[model samples]
Target: MIILMGIRDDEQVQRLISLDSKSSLADVVTICRSYEAAKCATSAIRAPPDQLRAVSAYKKGKKNKGHEKNLSTKPSPTTATFCKCCAKQHEPIACPATQSICTSCGRQGHWARTVQCPANQAQCLFCGHVGHYDKCCKTKKKDGRQSGSSGNSSAPNNNKHQDTRINSCRHLGSAAPTATKTPQPLNVLVSYGEATFHLLMLPDTGADVTVIGKRHLEILGIPQSSLQPPACTTTLTADGSTMAPALGIFKATLNLGKRSCPARILVHEGVQTPLLSYGHYKAIWL
Candidate 1:
């Protein structure tokens, strides 16, 4: 039988001998020492092959090639022709110039549908007087002779007109108007013993506690407490992983506008910003 000996000073060798009573020369066929096994392992690791040489050559080839160029570039500026009447540069579809004459006022700049005759105080469009369009007419049905009474009767009321205007003004095709409460900015104040600090009110209802950074705490001359307990809870970040919480709470006074509230300031170990968490805001203000 083959025997392996791991010698480590006198104590280890004695311990190994005690494990087996058959350590005698008559029982052993071959004995392999630890030093011999280590030398064989070292020699195998140092030896290089064809695959390693090929990999080194490929890396050198990549280094010789330059970096790749970006595919994106800035867009060119757009130019447009100006309209003769409006004097504005736009496409033909967007030009406001009109050719139809106003029947009531005898004008050529606008269509008959929008002609308001200032001479007789008559709207040619609604009165069907021929020169102006129907939209610019200001005459009531009772005061003047109604030429297009039938068309006026079929027109929409004021409420429907307002609704049409609102719908046309909307940019998103199918979005419903949703009511949202606007977030108000916060007022911040820091106090340590005799020293005082004034800060903005940052109301964040999503956070677990009120927090101040290390820089602010050090500036206020606040000493580190030895009795503080280590944070046990973990927080999940936007990157989809959990990190150990390095947060702690300290006592402080926060002035919110005209009123002042006693707040428990939470200190995040590596944070640089002074933030009031949603939990603290809801507890104090809301």
Candidate 2:
């Protein structure tokens, strides 16, 4: 009861209450750490503009205390606008660091620390092209028909359920899609162990498990051989076809805006795009 009362957060309290006889103190500590880590990783504490300016002014005054410097004649730091890009006082958009190269993706137009890199600006996982992600890649099909709306459009659908190992092709259709409406990819920033990725994922309510491609694992700097086997041995796809036996599975924290959810991600070979499961969507958004 004291532990329950101490937890001010409704979510934290609810999680603790849900545990049964199997739960231990370690579970409680893990829950607390997850919330604390999420809060620290996602939030930025900053002083108000006025308070920041006042501190700047105080520092400037202290630096020229002995000298006869005309403090009033100079433009006051308290009234100046702070520029995050170049760490100078100037207009927000008029940053001199705009011309500098971004260390994140090696782009030359923006500062990586101050701005979010555009998804289209990154390399596409499927086509090995720039200006788009694998989710938006339109690769040609084997039957001279365009692989329309198929998640793994780059790879040709051969084998035809004959392979011994499980293979999951979520939307491998032979016909071209006639619908003009396109599915918007969900942009998520995910962090695993220590690596972080700016990903464009497809929100799949159909998939029971969140899936990440082998290429994505490589990009995250995680080796394919290092992951653990999934709880389920055989996996089935949306089309009722057996999914290729998973390469492995790993737990990662997915961040969307200010919300974060821990998800068990399955790694599969030949998958181009990442699939965000419905359960994870509810955990983060609802």
Candidate 3:
């Protein structure tokens, strides 16, 4: 005589009632609630097998199998002879005839030549060429061979062709060497609040403002919040006219090796050049 009320699955409920008519309806309801809770707990405890298979399949698809194969099969570039002074990828311009000391190693008897380090089998760090070490690489050497200077017809004709090729490489500009002077070190004095400090000055014409190192900032007692503009600005260096942005300005005192001077500070996230710029030089003059 037990009646199960409000059961959605009437057939299952009826079957249960029929099996145990002596049981109270409340007891049936409790059994049903317990069954539902057990089913939910089982589901929460374990993921479906199909879901695990799908995740494995996705991971397999994302793997770079082809790239790995290509990397394993590819050959590395051939090592070239490197110059130590110019760090160029060619024969040393300073031959034995010149008898120049290696600008890189500062050793006697050999002229600037490819970075072939007789002492080390390892490649030159500067030029990535085998047969030389970084101390023997001269990749930075300027080209002294003048095309028109030879006064030979072949030389002039070759120069014209080279100029044409260079011009074509640029979209709207003529071909010209954009070389800049190398950077040199200068002395600087930094003051944070009442504390005075000394540091190496690196002038960067590429920089619109001056910068102070993190250690200098801390020593000067300048708070981070005191800096203006919250973010750095982009700038270039006089050497090679390299471009970079600066973070912002800070209030600090700068002394060029000789005397202490009041100056505005520009902060940068990283060091690019060791050169000093006109802004810094002018500050020194003042």
Candidate 4:
């Protein structure tokens, strides 16, 4: 009978880390490759971020700054505009606003507002309100019109109430923005075309698709033109947010515990780890 394994919880990860006190998360994954763990090494991918340490000389520090910087706790991109060239999060960098450059606003000689070359001004995506753009949508602006007959005896109090209501409107309209995720690194051996090497993977049940970093593609010796864009998909993170429009997907083999099989992965930047999800866990023969 075939069996499936889900991601390991905190207890399981802690126990596993405690067992091989000396093994780092990556090393432990290798150990699992040797041992007979039926689940993807990604299951034990979490180990308090401490398992991600060097064997030579361990030290204490802050969170995954590399990832934190890219996928930091900062607010998510409010703008849906993506780069026409790279399809990254924002639009400024892709086509910098300079002489004759687009500002993602579709104006010539200024910053382009459109994504494509023949910049076209589109309607507001949010609120469906025409004129204003999505990022600057003000549909839900609070109706702060004060309730007064213009002859109230309490002049000072009425003014104060009006100001308070105005402030409240602004506050309500600006809700807390979604934050980004900082995945910990999980090192593993990835085999492709008979060549194998250790790579720091970020096993995230949160990540919808398992993606290889675009920068790491050079290590695999695959040209960008060789791979096509991945099918449209959505990724949900532990932070209760979704990652959309990953660069592309690729086929690879994950070697874990006497088990190696063809697996599909996604390719992205910012995070160092290769995303592995619970769905990927089912590939393992438990």
C-alpha local distance difference test of each model: 0.51, 0.65, 0.54, 0.53
Q: Whole-model lDDT for model 3 versus the true structure?
A: 0.54
Q: What is the lDDT of residue 102 in candidate 2?
A: 56
- Give, for candidate 3, the lowest lDDT window spanning 10 residues: 171-180
TM-score for candidate 2? 0.37
TM-score of every prediction relative to native: 0.31, 0.37, 0.31, 0.32
Candidate 3 ranges with C-alpha deviation above 4 Å = 1-183, 213-216, 219-221, 230-246, 257-261, 272-276
RMSD of each: 29.4, 33.0, 21.2, 36.5
Candidate 4 displacement at residue 147 in angstroms: 45
lDDT of 1 by residue, 115-137 (tens): 12332322122232322223444
TM-score winner, 1 or 2: 2
Which structure among the candidates has the greatest TM-score? 2
lDDT tens digits, residue span 22-43, model 3: 7786877778888778868878
Query: Largest lDDT belongs to which candidate?
Result: 2
Ranking by TM-score: 2, 4, 1, 3
lDDT tens per residue, model 2, 1-286: 2244577888878878888857777887888899999877655345467877888899988888835566556775566576655557776667787888655445566555443444323433233343433444454222224223343433444333223113212133311122122335778889987878888898664456899899988888888778988776788875568998888888889998999999889998989989887677556643
Deviation in Å, model 3, residue 28 alpha carbon: 99
Greater-lDDT candidate between 1 and 2: 2
Off by over 4 Å in 1: 1-185, 225-227, 237-244
- Candidate 4 lDDT at 190 equals 77
